[model samples]
Target chain A: MKTTAALSRLFAGIQADLDLVDKTFQERATSGLDILNTASMHAISSPGKRLRTALTLLSGKLNTYRFQKLLLLSVAFEMTHLATLIHDDIIDEASTRRGHPTVNALWGDKISILLGDYYFAKTAGLIADIEDPRIDHLFSDTVATVCEGTILEIMTSGNADLSQETYFEKIKNKTACLFAACSKGGAIISGASPEEIERLHAYGQHLGIAFQIIDDILDYTQDQSTIGKPAGNDLRQGMVTLPLIYALEDESQNGYRQQVQSLLTQTTHKEEDITAIVGWVTRGNGVKKSLLDAHAHGNKAREALYHFPPSPDRDVLDELIDFVLSRNK
Target chain B: MKTTAALSRLFAGIQADLDLVDKTFQERATSGLDILNTASMHAISSPGKRLRTALTLLSGKLNTYRFQKLLLLSVAFEMTHLATLIHDDIIDEASTRRGHPTVNALWGDKISILLGDYYFAKTAGLIADIEDPRIDHLFSDTVATVCEGTILEIMTSGNADLSQETYFEKIKNKTACLFAACSKGGAIISGASPEEIERLHAYGQHLGIAFQIIDDILDYTQDQSTIGKPAGNDLRQGMVTLPLIYALEDESQNGYRQQVQSLLTQTTHKEEDITAIVGWVTRGNGVKKSLLDAHAHGNKAREALYHFPPSPDRDVLDELIDFVLSRNK
Candidate 1:
């Protein structure tokens, strides 16, 4: 119960900051035109975790950084995250996200693609406003890393023989790198010590990896209703995640791999076939082991926070680490 | 004869700068990975006029501002432009651009969309490296404006009653604003006086309008062989350009509007019908008047350049203005 309360407090704080970022985005984009206002509001109001922005603000405040700079950095991080999501939805052929129709689904892939570019431009604009070339350079390099990661993911999609090293690199680029940037950038903006910045960045990086592992595990274990989408959707798309990696280790499961591969190759398969595969994975110990692995990483993430000075903000971050381990929905 | 010589000289100068910009882009994007290097080269090698980069370099040099800043700004502008074009090609369902298969046509829409985002991230990265928050803000705002313009165009397609004011606003955002930024940003980076920056901005704005108008005219007046694509492709797609605007003034041509509306409403139409509509618009006086209006804007563009002090660089600017007026392909 106490952990839930902490999570709520963190959520509310992040929500308020995101509201401010949304308002700033709207105010800057207003050209006294109704269409511009309407479109901007519609795009911004779409549901998201706002996790990237939260990481930026919370990390900065924990280090006693200036509020305004923290807000701007939060906005930039959120914009970059949003930009990638917009394009990713198109590539995934995902019609929905966060229980709402994706931009690509609602407006068609073309507008979604353009809007993604717009968000990227907005993020760049925010970075440029900071007036520090070092921050600018760091932000740009991070963006490139994210793109490279995405390309790597696309290239390796159906390759079951994908190595663990390749998987780590892909997840680091596609997920962890941005999270690391959020913490480190917040630290940079707030004038944190190099050591503190490094520690905070490590904390974010480990947390992101754990978070993605949990997500992958959920694909096998969670009910569609709670998850807000069909289970096994990733596997349906031929992406072999961690649970599948673990499940495929047994020689008996070699037949199971062939079944999954046949479904993928056919480009058409019954949902029941996917459900059977999900059941098989669940009956096995893979999901349980993946969860244990996630917990271990979550513990490591909390350990990285030890370098920071004691504060309530740091305490909330500590709670956040626990929340990641226990999150169900 | 004199005009041809001027254009030849202008193209030669632009070609040299484009080579340098291309080389720099390749060097910066290198990741010691063959796939990345190959993809970056293939994407950037796609055909374009390099107008944004050329404008940036010329504007900077026109003020006698000699620095590597122009190179950075030029690359940013070109990347931004290419990013938008990739998205635009998807939106327009265009299979060919500049007489070659579009990114979407060759790689599929999914890859095309991601590649566009890749360039956007790359452009943001470049701007971030420059470490100027003000310039970053400018680029971001410009990008947002371009997006809004594109959205507006999509929403307003086939609306025969679209006002001239709305058209100008759309073109300003979609085309002229970027050109203005190229000129003004180039000057700002070199620390030009505010007055000089504004004048160059005006020059770019007028030139961009002229350039777009000429393009619209060519859609009706130029043959497939000369223009390297089917003429009237825009009209077939239900886009009403300036020449169509002029053509619609006559009662007889009012039927042409109806034909366009009908074509747009249909899922598919006969090619003969499309060809007939193109022939009607071309034989009319509207296209001629539109060309004349384009020349007038070109003249205005030249007039805006009078604010700068005389130099050989300024002479090159004059030559570029003349080149814009005379180009037939």
Candidate 2:
């Protein structure tokens, strides 16, 4: 009951931080043009965890450098995250996101793409406004790293032979790198010591890995309503996440392999096929095992923060670590 | 004869500078990955005037900064330009660029999109390497403005009611802002005075506007072999460029507007319609008048540079002004 209450409190705090970032996004994109205004608002108003912004703010606070620059930097990271999401939807051919029709689904691919570009540009502009050379370099480098990671993901998609090492690298580039950047950049902007910056970066890296692993596990475990899309969608797309990796471990399961291959060969997948695979993965304990691994990562992430000065902010950071490993939503 | 010789000399110098930028682009993108090497080489091997890089180098030279920073900055701007072109081809559904199959046409839209992203990230990396706050800010601002301009263009497409003022603003953002940034940033990096930076920026602005106006005119007048794309293709897509703007001046040409409407109404466009419109626009001297306007703007661009001290580099700058206005191929 105490842990539940703590989780609730953490959720509320994150919600408030995200709301502030959304408000800032609104003010910055207030062009008089109607289409621009509508598109900008629609894109920003979507539900997101704002995890990147949280990492930025928490890291800055933990380093004892909470300031306007940190907030601006946080906003920049969130904008980049949002921009990438918008573009990713188009690339993934996803019809829905966050329990709503995607921007491409609503307005067509062209506007979705151009609007994504606009946000990327806006993010860069925001970072430019921060005006510290070290921060500027870090932000640009992070943006570049994120893009490279995305490209790596695109390259490896649907390749069944993709190794675990490459998958880790891809995830590091696509997801964890930005999280790492958020923490590292926040520390740099706040003028944290080099040691503190390194610690925060490590913390963010492990947290991101754990966060993505949980996401992959949830795809096979969560309800469709909670997942915001169909179950086993990633597997359908031939994205072999950790649970699938575990499922593929038994070379003697020829029947299972045949069933999976048959589904892969189908022109259009049926829900029953997806459900069967989900059931098999669940019965095999793949999901539960993956979750345990995620917890291990989360623990390591918290351990990385041990060198930081003890404070409430640090405590909140620890809570965040726990939240990643425990959250169901 | 003297004028022709002067023009030839200027062209030769510009070509040499373009070769240098191309070589630099090739060197920086030499990743061991075969796909990266192939894509980078394919993009850089295409023939372009390298106007943005030239502007960067020339402006830096004008301000007497003989450092490697300008070269790196020039490469960064050119990479960004190429990245946008890759994305633009996808957005425009263009099959050819520079008389060769576009990246999207040669590979696929998916690959093209990823490649464009790779270059965008690469440019950001280059900027980070420069490690200068002011240049970083300028580059980031230029990128944002370009994206905003692109969004505006997408929103206004096929809308005949779009005002000329809005069109100018869009072009200025999409095209002229980067050009202006190149000159202003180059001068600033070279430690030029405020007045000199402003003068160079004005020069870039006027030159960019004139450059685009000529480009728009060529879309109506030039042969496919020369312009490397079908003439009147923009009009076929319902884009209102300067020549089309002037052609629509007479109310009696309501028929022309109706023809445009009819063309757009079709499920598929016929080449005959494109050919007919191209003929009409050419005979009407719309292209000639547009070129004359380009010349007027080019003269204004030259005037902006009059405030600077007289040097041989200034002569080269003056020559470039006339060259951009008169170039046919």
Candidate 3:
């Protein structure tokens, strides 16, 4: 896996462009109303990885798309991400995001909810000028998919009935779809040809799958402080992600299946049990197998990019797949 | 003011057209998922005045725009209204809407919140096909404005310092904006000329302001059984609407402002106090002044339409103004 220093150097070429994204994001979040304006600023000011905007900027650079249009598209994608993050925090009952107090934590859920909607409105407003039918539906449909995916996850929470296939489906909806939209939407707006667009779509899909798997793996592998969230948060919330799903498969073949099943199917969890399960999942080959699976998706993402000529932008995208896969400790 | 029966007769010509709207609304509400599809259906099925749809259809008839496009635009307005309604119910903690269980009441706030987002996504999906930049920004900005307005209301909720001007400003952002959008959007999609569009915009603005004034007036004047919501709801929630703003003026002149000011400033309310405040506001002709103010706006709406030739659609638009005024009783 690439080191942090390597990843930073890979993106250094786009640092100037990313700074533009930061400025645009902050500028667009201004609402003119004091409270809303402040909340909007605060929501965007959080240090997001800017992954979606990076994907968008990188994709646009693949072709000779208008720089101005690409900037707008990048802003739209970032705002869309921020919008959902607010709602996601509310659902997770999370008090902090990126080590900062969440909008929900600081202002409460009512403001968080509306602030999220405001961000979405800002996203749509940014894209409204794009005037592409494909770009138009791509965003709203992605939102619907993300919301549906989260709802499905909530409904399936604590169910021992969760399958590996369902786990992939859930992550695809909840996380990967937006990434796919970010890649495909940038290409579409950038005037990428049909085949190129399709290839980029696949690249985004595979990259997103790998990204989410690594996220799930991080839940078990990373310690509390570095991850900025409690380890095994998914388990405490009764959510079964990839690591536990693989762990359960291993446990089921042995004698510990029912023990894990009882813990999962229970409506609530004791903290110690959560800790034990996190440990058990890590001790098993669950984390190992998950990383391997993520690597497989990463390879697919690389393969999808083979048709595009190797430019700096394409190289960064290629490195990003590795960067996402290597994010875990 | 026109009687309810007279208003119904005025709309008879568009009865067939409205039936088509009902059909389209139902057809569009269907998602493949059981929960969302059912929730969508439930959200729309509760009988509404369908006033926004009516405005769109009637506005379309004044111009030569395609009926099909008008249908899409009208449905967009209704869905936008429905989307905000779901979120509004969450903020209000409302249990029932129009005598039917609210989405928040039937589903938890989590579902309600996502369901609201789903509806918004649906609304955007519908309008993404419109290809008009004006309509696109209109829906999104109206959404932002509505959310901002609600946040402002919440921030100022127990503050006795709210002014009459501020109350109007709040309602304009929260309620009048959507109504104005319905009018202007319909005209824009229907290909109305710039001048005519401005006229229709004014008509909608005045109509919406009048509509909201009457709505606030009804909260004090109507019975719980008739309104399907508790009377004095705004007061119980510590919101100072136009009626109270006007009543405060009357009370101040009579040296009773401090008593009412203390009640308004309270965060929580006893049932009897809510009842007493409701009576106090009514006794001072707050409801009467509010209705008169609504009528003045209604007259302005009528005056805005003076240039349009007499047709069934135009006549209905005019009488609809009176119907909204008479709805208080």
**TM per prediction:** 0.93, 0.92, 0.95
Overall local distance difference test of candidate 2: 0.76
Q: lDDT rank, highest first?
A: 3, 2, 1
List model 3 lDDT by residue over A1-329, tens digit each.
23446655777887888889889878888876898877777787776457887888788778876667778888988887887888888888889875788989989998988988888888888888777878889888988888888788877888765899988888888898988888888788789999998888888888999999998899887776777788888776778888788877874446656666788777677888878888988999889999999999999999988789988788899989978888753
CAPRI grade, predicted model 1: medium
lDDT of 1 at B148: 77
In model 1, where do residues sit more than 4 Å from their true spots? A1-6, A11-19, A25-40, A46-48, B1-8, B11-18, B31-36
**Candidate 1 chain B lDDT trough over 10 residues, lowest sum:** B1-10
Candidate 2 residue lDDT tens string, B14-106: 566656667788887765346667877887777653678878877888776655788788888988888888888888888988698888897
- Model 2: lDDT of residue A204: 92
TM-score of chain B of 2: 0.92
The 10-residue segment with the lowest total lDDT in model 3 chain A = A1-10
Model 1 lDDT per residue over A1-329, tens place: 34345566776756666678767766654544465455456666765446677778778877666767777777777777877887898888898765677777877776777677777777776777666676676677777787778778777787666666787788888898998888888888778888888988898888888888888887777776766678888778778777777787767778777786675555666889988888988888778878888888888888898777788778767777777777765
Query: What digit string (tens of lDDT, one per residue) describes model 1 on residues B123-197?
Result: 776766555565777788888889878877777787766666777778888988888889878877777788888
Name the 10 consecutive residues with the lowest summed lDDT in model 3 chain B.
B1-10
C-alpha lDDT values of all predictions: 0.75, 0.76, 0.82
